[model samples]
Target: MLLEKLRAEVLEANLELVRRGLVLYTFGNASGVDREQGLVVIKPSGVDYDDLRPEHMVVTDLNGKIVEGNLNPSSDLDTHTLLYREFPAIGAVVHTHSEYATSWAQAGLDIPALGTTHADYFYGPIPCTEPLTDEAIGGRYVHETGVAIVKRFAGIDPMAVPACLVAGHAPFVWGKTPDDAAHNAVVLEAVARMAIRTVQLNSLAGVSQSLLDRHYFRKHGANATYGQKS
Candidate 1:
């Protein structure tokens, strides 16, 4: 019963990515973990959004082995599995090649904490993890991707910063559930767009620390509502 719900949730969330224009063709994927069962539900490899259904979703164990479904799981399955195993608190993962965020990744620069909108979701600049080394990429690129994420945030709180850009790649976001992860993905793209526009308008402008703290506090601190009751 729970697995069924998670499958449906992951399927719908993947569609949300398409609806929000965060992904083109089948360049993105979403996954949700049923920790109780140690299984994950994710979009099938290369499946178009219009054709996706609950059953079309692939089920795999935390070890990334297929448990059920006709098609193979997404290529990012190993990366998702690694994150879930390492961060039990995370229930969902989203990966996307959205134009703006990917642009930042390719530049090998972090997304600055530029506006209140950016600080609402992230307390500081959204970081970009370094590219995986050739040796690590060959050994287990997906696993090493997770390692990169963990190392980048070794002493930091992952919850406080829920999204990251993979250097020379795309952005990946996580949350307590598929919905939250999808929401973060949308927010990430939006903020990335804003940041780029800000730079275009004035290349010398930078996000100030005072603004960042105020915005982060209002939305993330004890009094934070973000217009929604928690």
Candidate 2:
């Protein structure tokens, strides 16, 4: 019961991925971290989303050892843990093979910021990480998966851009909370789909820096004015 609320939030976030068509079958996972407790709550591996429950969420230490739950933790648990450990601002992580976003990942291409929709959620283009080496893939694949993402963000701020594509894999998104991470995943897919079409129409199409800054700042940070104020 230590992470009960966090478990529920992670459960709901997982279901949101299914509801939004970002996940099919059991192809995705969602997790939330309790930084104060140094624990994480995540969906169990291979469990169908329709049957998932708050109690089914597996609790684990940041080192990826399970502390609670009867089921196995998600296969992507290491990726979540590494992100939480390295990026202190991220409280949740979501991995999904949503069509358009995964397509970009498989192609090892970034989703270009073609319009305000892309810029609104992502400060710039959604980056795709470099392909993993055979050594990395043959070893601790999951842990190295996290390392690749962290490397891709070497000079980037995780909060400013909350998502990335793993070459030949899928998309991983994070946020200040589990629900927020799931929301960003949805937006990533939407914009990814749009970007695909935009490029098809005009390969050189791109959003200007001024327009990107305006849309991104208006909805985020201290100066944000897009939604109802808390």
Candidate 3:
């Protein structure tokens, strides 16, 4: 148990995705990084949720090398690791083919900040990455997935948005901890579902920058006041 607590947190986050209906069958995975020890604990690849336990969580180094565990790490380990390396502020990552978000991704559309519900979590539009080039796809598809995501956030603060929807794929969400990542995943799905309906009602619908800034900053900005003081 190299990362005993991180293993349990990763397990719980994976289970949370299933419970929240963000993942289907064995289609998605969740992982947590212990920044200090430079280790990651992730859900075992393709394993059924019902069969998972803390021990089944695999431990790997930052480069995706297995340090402990009998099972293979999630296939998206490289993407998770890249995010950990690039976005040092994040503590955990969760990837899911959540229906609404995936729909936007498949359409190669950004989920717009159509209302406060979306602005409350995502500061602006939830971005969709540019599709991977054929060369990147052929060479190292999984690792390149992370490259596209990082490219999309070139000038943005990853902490401000905390999520990215990969073009023609699905969404990857992260936060300060495994539970926080899971929570953000659930919110991402909710807003995405709402965005679809909002668009149908009015294609011109969108929140103004002033309102977007107000809602986003109220909760996530330096002087956040949405919830009671921590």
Best-fitting candidate, scored by TM-score = 2
* CA lDDT scores, all candidates in order: 0.89, 0.94, 0.94
Per-residue lDDT of candidate 3, residues 131-212 (tens digit)? 8889988998999999999999998889889999999999999999999999999999999999999899999998999999
Each candidate structure's TM-score, on Cα atoms with residue i matched to residue i, is 0.92, 0.98, 0.98
Q: What does the lDDT come to for candidate 3? A: 0.94
Number of clashes recorded per candidate: 0, 0, 0
RMSD (Cα, Å) of model 2 = 0.8
After superposition, candidate 3 runs with Cα above 4 Å error? none
lDDT by residue for model 1 (20-73), tens: 999999899999999888999989999889999998889989999888889988
RMSD of each: 1.8, 0.8, 0.9
Q: C-alpha displacement of 227 in model 1, angstroms?
A: 2.6
If the candidates were sorted by their TM-score against the true structure, best first, what order would they fall in? 2, 3, 1
Candidate number with the higher TM-score (2 or 3): 2
Cα lDDT for residue 40, candidate 2: 94
